[model samples]
Target: MDNPQRNDNPWFMALYIGGAGGILATYILIGFFAARWLVGMVEGPRYWIAIGTISGLVLGSFHIVMLIKKMMGEQDG
Candidate 1:
């Protein structure tokens, strides 16, 4: 009998972790630049900081969800 939960390949795990880390790093960089740009706007830096942070979190979560879905689908196949 084959075990569904066991993944013998280490490369997949490494790639997944690397991709997730890259996504997180990208979000952080985007937030940093957005905040910097928004700081010069009339509304002030606080609003832009909040907006950037929230957007980053939302985007990161979405990426994670999509990755999980893709992984599950691949496993099922």
Candidate 2:
């Protein structure tokens, strides 16, 4: 009997990467715009720094969720 090949489907990997990349890109653009607006109105370097840090945290959390979901899907498959 032949053994089944695991990880044979590249499409699955591509789909996962593309979807996550798209969302991350969108989040980054939105974060940049929001930060720009905030900095324009807030009038301080501290506020700019805070906005960047917050955006990084948000993006990082989103990436973590995506990673968990991908892992779960792979396990289920």
Candidate 3:
């Protein structure tokens, strides 16, 4: 019996990189816009900074979790 070949395409790696970049960019944009809006309502730069930092951290954590789940699923398959 022969073992099946694993997918080792460079394009897949490129796609993963591109997808991660896109997600990062999206989070950054979201953080920027959210901070800007918060700044309008709040009176200080500190609040906006805190809002942006918290939002970025939350989004980053979520992205990491999803990425881990995807990698684990691929390994199982």
Superposed model 2: Cα runs more than 4 Å off: 1-9, 46-50, 53-64, 67-77
| Weakest ten-residue segment in model 3 by summed lDDT | 1-10
User: Which residues of candidate 3, in runs, are more than 4 Å off?
Assistant: 1-7, 72-77
Worst 10 residues of 1 by lDDT: 68-77
Clashes of 1: 0
Per-candidate TM-score against the hidden true structure: 0.66, 0.54, 0.62
lDDT: which candidate is best? 1
lDDT of 1 by residue, 1-77 (tens): 56577665889888887998889778867886788688866568467777887788778878887887766665544
Model 2 clashes, total count: 0
Evaluate model 1: give its TM-score. Answer: 0.66
What is the C-alpha lDDT profile of model 3 across 1-77, one tens digit per residue? 22255345789767876887777778877887778777778765757766796787679668966985664455543
Q: What lDDT would each prediction earn against the true structure?
A: 0.76, 0.68, 0.71
Clashing pairs in 1: none
